[model samples]
Target: MTQSPAIPLPPPAERRRLREAQSLTQAQVAERVGVGRDTVRAWEAGRTTPRGRKAQTYASLLAAASATAHEVTLRQADPTAPLTPLTPAQAFDALYAFCAPALVRQAYLLTGRRELARESVERAFQLAWHRWPEVAVDPDPAGWVRATVYECALSPWHRFRARHRHPEAPPADPADRALLAVLLRLPPPYRRTLLLYDGVGLGLPETAAETEASTPATANRLLHAREAVAARLPDLADPALLSRRLAEVAAHERLRAARPPVVRAGSERRARNWTHAAIAFTVALIGATTFTLHTAPTQYNPPVAPGATVQGVPPRAAPGALSRAELDLRTKLQRAATNGPERLTPDAR
Candidate 1:
């Protein structure tokens, strides 16, 4: 097969400036290019150059961005010139169209589930659509979406979810089934490394960075994974042959990605739903707070304690009962005291 067309790139410094001028992040560029953010950073830093298909894609993106900027400049210079810029939806659709089909196929290779592959691809694109501002000028929008797809397709969490609890039917072809089984046997990290390096045609450094491993470690994983594959399928011993076989396996699957408009509309609908939910939650919280404020007690009324005797004070003694002599004098006074003051008074002290 003929190689993709490659073009001369500007000096590394200028290349970075061109991307920066477009307000594109290194991470976005890397995502589109199917490499790690750090790989793009390395490209900008002049530590490396993009190669093969990735190089061609990178060049095309830069050139297109540069051309657009020039168009904008010319429009600004001559206000009457009709200005055209890619709308977010249009840009998103382009990105989805370019990446979705291949992503679905790749995802199937990873999960060996056609439905899951399609779902993962759609989910990834949905996320990209949600973060269009970031994805729009991303140097590698495809890569960004691809990473999400890979994560979604290979997530262990999916196994626990109801829909994905049981394993899907294996491929009809024994060889395809066996290959998938073997791929699944390898650890996720090793499997991912092999796919990116061999199947996806990523450079060693790019693969290592994307996999979040050091170059040496990535190399080790690749070696071990390849060794396992070669030991199992001796005929596909060569790396190129192995890569080709992987492609063949992926191509054999008839998975179809959701259409661009459907994906875009779904993304919008999902975002809208989330926004409405958030607003509802906020309103509920505000209402609850208001209700509490209005219904709460207005003043503090201290509780009254039961009465108790005074501490440290003695009780007064009760008077003795009236004596007999006092009673006799009281009787006499009652009978004689009406007319005489002397009679009312007692004679004895």
Candidate 2:
């Protein structure tokens, strides 16, 4: 019988919990995941993202084992409550209700396109539904959904598609348009930092954690972001005033401010249909656009070492081709090689 591969590692914070739930040591996990123990340690410690097929298997194994243990614990804790697995429908409904509105607003703020924001948020929620088992148990499920939305908003294919569509609501006045234009003109990192900080009202540490930067580095980015915005739009220089203005702009521009409707219980087919539709649309778009996705590999060759020649390639000796310095160096090396034994004499030396 073929043994199934281990599941991929979950988020760094939850790795330990998942491991402990299965009563597995790091060594056991490493062996199962087909990685070194130190690799498992690095994953649990948040030093790196678990890469490759083993990562997916490791996460699957942990989530499956964790679900079983979780249900057992729940049953022990409460006799009346059923020990049912969390279904896709329930997870989708819960995450959508909790996160949809805020994520819509964040997407709008990021993209400056209202309809695009709605679509991005829904698409992210749909994806969350498909992977609910893994995502539902994440330490910050809402954050996970939000990150997915952010990815959708920033995707190049989506951006290209969005260029032809008009925004649902254009700015009513020139000032609003100017402010938004300047805000969007900032670099992506600075813009995201500003939105997470000023627009979403996340504190320094939370924003830092979300952006995967240290607190000090997040602060520096925020400061520079403020300075850049202030330099361009002098009225926005004041931190408090900027935050208030951002809130007001977002309020005015948000297409949907209401929470998503509850997905009925046992509507797994409905949820799957929604997710499948999104996937189909994305596929169609890719086909229509002839989009080619490029992935960077984990390893690449460095440039040729200094002073090393390619094998079988003779030095350039043509008069015009050789620079004076190059010619001098080559001539000196050739002379030294030719004169080696004879030049070893004391007088020659």
Candidate 3:
């Protein structure tokens, strides 16, 4: 692979000016450039200049951001511009510009390819743009976007394509590459935990949520990942130092995510209409099924033919009556018995 051309370093004052113009804080710049806030401050104060690849990234970010005003930070850049109230599009533009580099870096760490990382970040930002109203009101929009990027980077869509893509090349530094190879061989969840916690600098809870793991599970994964790496590199066995080393190596290369194209109001309206239509169709289908079950006609047993034998039950018996002659005889016999008692009394008289 060809080496990337070295970027010319801008003047310290110019760097500070471009950064302030874009309304970026030293901490924000530091995070994007993968350095400490004090380092950025020192750069601005002329106490130091970023060296090596760090200088290249710092210079490139300033050079790119100088060309356009970020919609979200316009008010910060110019207090009197009356642009404090920003539209969703404007707000998204600002957020994308500010967070894209770091998000891409994190994604690259996950996927091990610059282009793939850029693609994931761009997709995440586009999703954020579509749901900008919700994203803008969120307490941590950057976290929300970062989480989306994590999902995108780990998507099943990349599963097959990844097999065809060139694998991550080992660095010229044998020791470093050996460690990286070991890390790369770890399970996906373990590697993701290490990257988010140590590489991307997210907290435990944040990393857990991004990886969709519980806090305890995330902690376990991190522990396991650390142990695995330490097992391979015993000399750097201290967890803290190991974490820092991995972080530095993971963030070595970063590609800035481009601002995604905005959706027009009409297109959004159409999309919403389609969503509502789908919901209505589903509800109607369920209602139809319920009605069919509840109102379905039941079948009755067939009537028996005139001489046909009945099944399962016996037939009723015929009714009977006593004869008149028999009734008369029964009355006479009763009368005779009563009379006989009187006759016997006469004989005695």
Error of 2 at 54 (Å): 37
Candidate 1 per-residue lDDT, tens place, 33-66, comes to: 8999988988877776666478747866776666
Q: What's the best-to-worst order under TM-score?
A: 1, 3, 2
- Across 108-154, the per-residue lDDT of candidate 3 in tens digits comes to 66666677877778777767767777988876676677788878887
lDDT of each: 0.78, 0.68, 0.68
lDDT of 1: 0.78
Q: CA RMSD for every model?
A: 13.8, 23.8, 14.5
Error of 1 at 339 (Å): 53
Clashes of each: 10, 13, 0
Instruction: Give the per-residue Cα lDDT of candidate 1 at 8.
Output: 36
Give the TM-score (vs. native) of candidate 3: 0.53
**What lDDT does candidate 3 reach at residue 334?**
95
Which residues of candidate 1, in runs, are more than 4 Å off? Answer: 1-83, 298-349
- Candidate 1 has a TM-score of 0.65
